[model samples]
Target: MRHRIKNSLALVGSIAVQTFRGDAPAGAAMPRFMERLKAIGRAQDVLTGDGEVSAQLRELVERALEPHRGGDCRRFRIEGPDLRLPEASATALAMALHELATNALKYGALSRDDGCVVVRWWVQADGSGGELRIEWREQGGPPVVSPARRGFGSGLVERALAAELHGRCVIAFEPAGVVCEIRAPLPRVAG
Candidate 1:
């Protein structure tokens, strides 16, 4: 109980620190920061629940994208099997997904009325062990171009997948839209 409390406090402190460290005006930054904290809280809720040792992948994805769903949930298509992910991996993946959704809403498919996004995932067996591959594809948006430099969202997505879940993340800006793919070892990500 004490350990959990300590960890929770630490997480809150970290969020606060990150929130204030940004240069954006407080009026604009506060909302985005709060949204991110809420995302983390939802992931924590899933991780701490006693009903299951692992979290459902679909639930995590939904939670990550929920804030951005707006009134056009139909514009997003999410499909995957009932896969379970370990607490750490689930949290990391949730954060990554949030970044993707935020970017989409800001500049990609979700920004346009006719644009759409699709998220898909599957498990595959390799010589050593199985792997999970998640793909995020956006279409029907304005022409896409790679960013001149990586931003905080891109860095967070790449680093969290690599460091926290031992995964590889790739982001591509095709002329049509953007594509983000994440591949991670099943044993490590589904512990």
Candidate 2:
């Protein structure tokens, strides 16, 4: 049930981005896509849930779509040893992370001279497999509350990118800042 719900959310989020963001879809009707997104939104109140799972899922979506408020700084950094993984997955993750980081520089925590952003990643062996850990932190910004509505960006980061990598995201809205963390199994790389 939970997997299905999350998948549905991702689907809606993907189509919403395509429908609204000027990205062209091969054959789906735009109106139909919008309806699907609305239905998914109604089916789950992603914002109301609590606990680690809920918090992580919400954070995944939130970080994927960090919005830029006015006067955001434009500086940040990324840290992580390069892992051998599918190029597509790496690209997608990088793209999503870049979007959030860029937005933070423009409007979120990194927008001011006093603000900064830090992104870190690492690979840890777990049991029979390996897991990847990635974190994004916003150092300074105006006070922010969890938004009442989930926008296209959040939906994409949480649902789409996460599904692609078979991972979960965790976002936290803190009194002093914002933080996003993602954990996914490291995929095998073909020779």
Candidate 3:
């Protein structure tokens, strides 16, 4: 029980630190911070649910993006096999997905009525072991250009994937939109 409480507190602390690190106006930042906090809470609920040792990847993705799916749910597409992820990996990946969805809403494809986002994932056999690859692609929004400096979201995605899931994350700002790809060893992601 103590361990669970500690973990929950740590998660909240991390969220608070990350959410307030920006210089955005309070009105703008408050809603985003609340959304992110809710995302983390949902992921924690999944992790702590009884009788389920692992979480469904699809479910995690949906939970992460739930807050962003407004009247036009059709703007987002998620395609992936019914893979199971360990608790830690699920939490990390869920957070990363939340960040991506937030960015999409703020600056990428989801920002426009005509824009859309496609999220896909697959598992493949590698020389060492099986690997999982996930991609987030946006289209029909404003043209994307690489940022002059990495922001908190980019750094969080890269570091979390690398440290927690032993994955490599690449963020590409293409002419059309933003694309994020993550590749991780299956064993690590599956725990």
Question: Per-model C-alpha lDDT, please?
Answer: 0.80, 0.57, 0.81
Residue lDDT tens for model 2, 131-166: 988788888776656767755556556766688789
- The root-mean-square deviation over C-alpha atoms between each candidate and the true structure, in angstroms, is 2.4, 12.4, 2.3
lDDT of 2 at 142: 68
Model 3 lDDT on a 0 to 1 scale: 0.81
Q: What is candidate 1's lDDT per residue for 102-156, written digit by digit as tens?
A: 8998999999988889999998889868888899999988898898998667877
- The C-alpha stretches of model 3 lying farther than 4 A from their native spots are 25-28, 188-191
Query: For each candidate, what TM-score against the reference?
Result: 0.87, 0.60, 0.88
Candidates sorted by TM-score, best first? 3, 1, 2
- Give the clashing residue pairs of candidate 3, or none: none
Candidate 2 vs 3: which has more TM-score:
3
Task: Mark the regions of model 1 whose C-alpha exceeds 4 Å error after superposition.
Answer: 1-19, 188-191
TM-score of 2: 0.60
From the highest lDDT down, the ranking of the candidates is 3, 1, 2
- TM-score of candidate 1 on Cα atoms, chains taken together: 0.87
Poorest 10 consecutive residues by lDDT, candidate 2: 50-59
119-148 per-residue lDDT for model 3 (tens digits)? 999998879878989999999999888889
The alpha-carbon deviation from the true structure for residue 84 of candidate 1, after best TM-score superposition, in angstroms, is: 0.6
